[model samples]
Target chain A: MEGLSQGEVIYIIVLGSLGMFLFIAGFAVFISMYQKRMLQEQEKRRIIELDYQQQMIQSQIDSQETERKRIAADLHDSIGSLLWAAKLNIAYLGRLSNFNGEMKDSYLETMKILDQSIDSVKRISWELTPEAFHNTGLSSSIMELCSRLNGKGQVIVFKEKGNQLFWKDDRALMAFRIVQELLNNAVKHAKANSILVNLNWNSNRLLIEVQDDGIGFTLNDKIRNGVGWWNIMHRSKMIDAAIEVKQNHQQGSAIELTVPLSS
Target chain B: MNKLKVYIADDHTFVRKGMIRLLNTFDRIGEVKEAANGNELIALVKKTIPDLVVLDLEMPEKNGFDTSKHLIDHYPEVGILILTMHTEEVFILNLIELGVHGFLNKSAEPEEVERALYAVADNDFYRNEIVNHALRSGVRRSTEASSAKLSPRELEILLLICKELTPHEVSTRLQISEKTFFNHRSNILGKIGARGNVGLVKYAYQNHLLELSA
Candidate 1:
């Protein structure tokens, strides 16, 4: 290894330094490309969440439309048929006025029962409407719904906090809807003994609570097939409200929703 | 015979028609009118006086509360029975104040409907499960509002007493004298404005503090 000229040595060292610099710059470009890919992935996830919300809403609309049809069918098939039979039977009973007092009373009672059953089935259909708020206020409508639910299995109790209530048509409609959706969910699934609904209005916010004493969801798991819950959250979002649900310290679960009043 | 004349208001034609059939079965039931909406119910009610008005909460036009309020204001003699599926506590409390005498679930048995109609038609006051629940909630709420007034020791003693603890037992448990326990009990009664021990228990029950031991 003979010594090289000083200029040649300087040129070699400079070229080596340039090569090292190029390697680092190439690595940095690859890292930047990787970061861009990750950002695209994140954006894709956000779009998917939004799409899920839309789909959930569409499915709810579809289900409600379908429910109206099925309820109509139930009335026509089950209750309607029963009433027609009872009406025809009443005519038959009228022909025999000479029957004993006990038999007459029994027939009359049966007819009354059948008639009322027919009414029950039909009224169920009428209750499931978004227009109830415009007709009554949201507060009254919720109470009426809760009382009606008392017939099923569980006892539903409603309570309001404070003397005043704050709701515009849109917020009232949202509150009504969320409450209805929660009750529907309970009826369909929550095999509970009782449900408690609390509607509170403070100066700053309107809070709605739907709770039940039943088999609650696990801490780790999302509520299974909770389309209505998602719809409620989406509506809450639309109004810039916050929503939270948790398995209460008691046996059941509670849903807490807060909608800002002035904000 | 009271000869109670009732008006059944529901949007669905079948419900109104069906209830009419049931009411007609009773010999005392006279002048049964059918209404498909709140507007029709209120209008007809104005024309022909009804002894008992059965209103639906969910209607396309005015709802049961609105119609009932109008009827109550115009004619206090007319007893209003709200018929609907909703049982939220706030709704019950709100309507109860509006002179609604009875609340019946749509799914109630025919016998129950008959009983409710008759009871409200003639009652000191109609208190059903839904209304009772709402009232209990109300009482508890008021107690919570007044919680600030009670001293910490008094609140603790009241909570213990609400657990159905005997005065002697409380004295032993709290390591206080029997006279001291009695004094604390009296103080609780005074603060709650209860007449006596039984009244205090009722207060505790209504406030939902009675079942704390459970």
Candidate 2:
């Protein structure tokens, strides 16, 4: 106090305080910026992981579809041809007048069996990969599926609203498969007697709802984690579609899938 | 007895040939012609019209649906038999509406096929037990939405009516004036394409608007 000047002491204090303030301000800005960068990096990583998962699901569905098609082709071409040839040969033998009654009866039985086999093979192949799904679009194929499923007291009421939609082939196929899985679930698990399939086609979206008068489900993580629901969810994600499964308390379940119209 | 000339149109060689052979064996069928696709059938039919044309639904050039329409338009006299594997009610109903004479499954027995051919040729229409059962069940699946686009209030009134409530009782139950109730009832009848309350009840049952369980 006796040696230092008042002016020098004031200057020293002023400089020290200013330096401390600047340091604190700079540290605060650096921390906020660093935090923002870390948040952005986490978002990027999450997106990348999601994208990877979608790609894997898409590829998995594609490979399964390709395998099904290959098997269907094999069944239709190889086995179907053999059965037809066998039936045709039997028919030709039947035309021979020298054949005895017993031989003729045996030939007739063989032809019938061959016809049944041909029908079965066709059915199995068609079930695996529907020709209508490729050729006639989604609506007709769904109707075909409904008819096939609607035998033996189980009733499926199908209704379509608005003009027929023109959709991308792969997306349409995925949607069909998803609906098929839902229907199969209804039959196999839901114990549904009557199912209603309603399709509403708007200008910008196609909404399909499958409602069943069955023992509805309770919305739970376990339900979503099931293989059928997981497959549906993955397929829906692959096509950029949305799905909502509602379970009524009394006795009904409905699954709604909405797909945006391809621009 | 005049032999029946049949025209068979199918895309598959196996199905086409098998059907052709089966038809040839039938004593009722005199001459049988084959077409690999709808275009060929249309061309062949234009030249020499068969008594009946057995059609497949899915074909290359034109589908069976379009072929049936074309046949009905041009050759109205020819009996059109849909021998499709498609047993869907919508297909059957649409074809029936298009004035097809008969509907037969491909898996039909040879005897049943003969019966259908004969019945369709002789009569204006044919409905076997299979066709009859299918039509009955399929007709029950008529478009429920198309039958009526009603308001919630109107639907509530409809359920009341289906429950056999009198107009006065319904008006009281709904807390609406009798005149207002009558107005709603008229609107309901018009929307549902029903003639009166009786028709409304029938429509309600048919469209499943009346949930019996409820």
Best by DockQ: 2
Model 2 ranges off by over 4 Å:
A1-10, A44-105, A122-263, B143-214
For residues B1-214, could you state the per-residue lDDT of candidate 2 as single tens digits?
7999899887777777777777777778999999988999999999999999989886778999999889988897798888765555556655765667777765566677788888678644565544444445444445544546889999899888766566677889989998998799788867866544434544565666764432
The residue-by-residue lDDT of candidate 2 on A75-146, one tens digit each, is 765676556545544664566455778987887788789878878887778778885455457887787789
- B135-208: candidate 1 lDDT, tens digit per residue: 56556445443342567777777766655465666788889998997788678867876533333544555656
Specify the poorest-scoring 10-residue window by lDDT in model 1 chain B: B140-149
Candidate 2 residue-wise lDDT at B27: 78
**Which residue window of length 10 is worst by lDDT in model 2 chain A?**
A84-93
RMSD of each: 15.3, 14.9
Evaluated at residue A5, the lDDT of candidate 1 is 98
lDDT of 1 by residue, A1-263 (tens): 98999999999999999999999999999999999999999999999998897778757755765686677655544465446445434634544365569987877677677667666655565465533355456676787789877878788999988755525376666677778877877666666788999988788887889899877655332367466667677677756788888565447889888878765
Top lDDT hit: 2
TM-score of each: 0.45, 0.56
Q: CAPRI verdict on model 1?
A: incorrect
Model 1, C-alpha of A58: deviation from truth (Å) = 4.3
